[model samples]
Target: MTSLLKQPVVDAINGQVVEEFTASLQYTAIALYFDSETLPQLSGFFHLQAQEEHMHAMKLLNYITEAGGQPIVPATKPVKNHFESVEEAVALALNQELKVTEQINSLVSVAVRENDYLTQQFLQWFVTEQLEEVSSMSDLLNIVRRAGKDLFRIEDWLVQNPHEAAAGGAA
Candidate 1:
């Protein structure tokens, strides 16, 4: 396999690292908003998402270093706007996950074009992660859509379906 640390591939990988960290920051902000608004279950869900994003960032950072590339320290941007409702929050989460999935695919395309097999291998994990993320977000959206205006019903739905939360960690 060609060394991915060389030139363009290194830059691409570093960019992905930054994006992963940014995703973590965004999800953490959503989590905090849920916590402040007294939605513990939603807060817990986003908190776990934030943790997962951080783990993804670290994984990419480590890969960059292992490939002899300098892992750039990521800068954090403020996440603005609190979600007005569960539906809005879940929709935002789904959109954000979709965005990340696109980013990962783009990166993988770059690696493939550059013939960087090692980078492709490294990105395989992220591809799987994005699949799980999109699926989870979609599932949440479906649940909230079904729950509609009944917040109590939504809470009950969550309580009855504990496996949904468990599946998030499975990714």
Candidate 2:
């Protein structure tokens, strides 16, 4: 199939696929951390996050294929497996979300520069998605910080706020 996306845009999306998969692995690491700590709610939250990130990667891959571009499923970069504190882990997640927001914005810029309306429209979902991702991670970080030594509070918050447990994906 002839590629609908220019080379630059295709390259950018492939890079984003790596980022998304890396995020999934990072979240899985965090979930393992929480599980070891015996915080089921927190662990479950990150497990859900990991699945969402994997889905995000798959979405980009599908978009690339549908656009007639050869989708490259590159290996993800290494992720931090250990974290000192709950706040530290949550902070890391928020930071990752922020970085991904920048990446998605860059993708949009590339589409705009190339005048690829189709690619630009296709990426709008991710553009809007970043807003929710960043916001949810930020909120989780705040809660973790405020809970301080009371880590159970964070778990309780996750329980009380079920939608938040799903990382803003729930209705």
Candidate 3:
């Protein structure tokens, strides 16, 4: 099939794939940190996040192939395995989400610039997803800050609010 995506759009999507895969690895590292700290809820939450990020990368890869563009499976960037505190770890996650949001916006811009209506439409899901991602990460960061020394409070909160906990890991 002829490629429906412009070269620039394909390139941007490939870059996003790298970001998503890196996020998956970072979340895995965070999960491991939580596990080493004996925090089951936090570990579980981050593990789930890692899976979600992996799925996100796969989604982008599938989209690229379905759009008749060549998909590049790139190596992930390095992830920080050690964190001093839960707040610091959550802050790192929040920062990453913010960066990913910007990248997704840039991808949409590229699709628009290239006049790739299909790609633009396809990227809409990611655009909307960023809102939830940022909001969830922001809420989690706030909870982590408020919890402070009471780390178990986060675990308890996660147990109480399963849905919110799944995404943001807190209410």
Candidate 4:
């Protein structure tokens, strides 16, 4: 079938796919760091986060394929494997999510420019997802701040508030 997605839109979505995968890899690195530090609970949280990111990428990949566009995989820079603390790691996550949000918005703007209603509609889901991701990451970082060198307290809080913590392993 002829592709409903324009080449530029396909390129943009493929870029998102790369960004999502990069996030997954970064989360994996963070999880490994947490595990090595003997913070199994935190590690598990990041592991779940990594899986979610991978899922996000796969969603985009499938969407592009379904639209009959050729999906391109881009090369990514190395993910940072070392973080001084949980706060640092969570902060990095927030920053990355924010960046991804920006990219998604840009794609929406492009769809608007091209008058591609279907692509614009498709991107709305990503807009909402990014909002949730940003909100969750910020909340987790805030919890870390409140815990303030008492990571175990954060862990306990996550246990008490499993839904809030479950996004990236806050639970």
Candidate 5:
């Protein structure tokens, strides 16, 4: 039976699942690093982020199965386990968010080019999600830079700003 999703699109989405899982692993590693550094709040934040990324990967896997395509699970790269500072870790996160945004944009472009309205509509959510991801990371990086080596300031900011703790920052 023919599937609603194109082969290339399914491949792309499967690739995206791997990317999301990779992000999860990266966050987990960062969280572990924060825990080792005695930054409980940051560690917890990244742990939550890792869970969100894992959820996103499962969501994509579901989409593939629902669309009658086989999801290709790929091995992710090893995550960097050390950071010089919270600022550096946050910078790495921002960079990853930017890359994910680029990837989502490319997927949207492909969906449009292929006239795959269903995929296009589905990817719209990701487009907005990416915007929020980028914005939140930018905000975090700015705060990290302002805090300098005072990691407590970041924890304090988190304590004071509960809204910033919103997972994935849905904007």
Candidate 6:
């Protein structure tokens, strides 16, 4: 059998796995912060976000193993749990998703430069995922921004919004 560790594609895959783990931690911290702030709906969204990130990590792990690459244990940093308002949380999410999208794009570029077709193909899913992630976060931010200072209106909007929860579950 070939050693996968020597391959750049394997390194990229490991990096993605680490990124997903970091995302999970970040989302969990966000969820806890929202929960403490008495925003259960927002907390639920972040909880689902955490779950989805965990799933993404597992998917990368499985893909690495299937590709004959040894899975590298990831060291994740603790996520901070402080936000001024609902808009702040949404902005954080948007920023995080954008960062993740850039990371994924970098990985894709690496694969392309290395002429690793398989790795590039695998990254296609991440490209699509980033699109959805950014869009969802943007939508939430827009709604919160439009809701203005009305906490009750924002809470009601969240209560009525269930698509993200369902979509996150599916992801």
- lDDT tens digits, residues 52-161, model 3? 88988999999999989999999999999889999999899999999999999999899889988998888888888778888877888888888989999988887886
TM-score, one value per model: 0.90, 0.97, 0.95, 0.93, 0.94, 0.91
Clashing pairs in 5: none
Residue-by-residue lDDT tens digits, candidate 6, 1-171? 565433777888788888889989898988898789888888888889999999998988887888788888799866767878878877988898999999999989888888877778888988998888888888888888998887666667777878865554685
Model 2, global lDDT: 0.91
1-24 per-residue lDDT for model 4 (tens digits): 899988888888898898899999
Candidate 2 C-alpha lDDT tens digits along 29-64: 999999999999989989999999999999999999
Clash-forming residue pairs, model 2: none
TM-score of 3: 0.95
The per-prediction CA RMSD against the true structure, in angstroms, equals 2.3, 1.1, 2.3, 2.3, 1.6, 1.7
- Cα displacement (angstroms), candidate 1, residue 103, comes to 0.6
Those runs of model 4 whose alpha carbons end farther than 4 Å from true positions after fitting are 168-171
lDDT value, residue 74 of candidate 3: 99
Please say which candidate is ahead in lDDT: 1 or 5: 5
Better lDDT candidate (2, 6) = 2
User: Once all C-alphas are superposed, what RMSD does model 5 give against the true structure?
Assistant: 1.6
Model 4 CA lDDT for position 7: 88
How do the residues 69-161 of candidate 5 rate in per-residue lDDT, one tens digit apiece?
888778996788889888889999999999999988888887888888998988888888877778877887898899988889998887777
List the candidates ranked by TM-score, beginning with the highest. Answer: 2, 3, 5, 4, 6, 1
- lDDT score for residue 150 of model 3: 96
Highest lDDT: give the candidate number: 2
Model 5 clash tally? 0
Top candidate by TM-score: 2
For candidate 3, the lDDT comes to 0.88
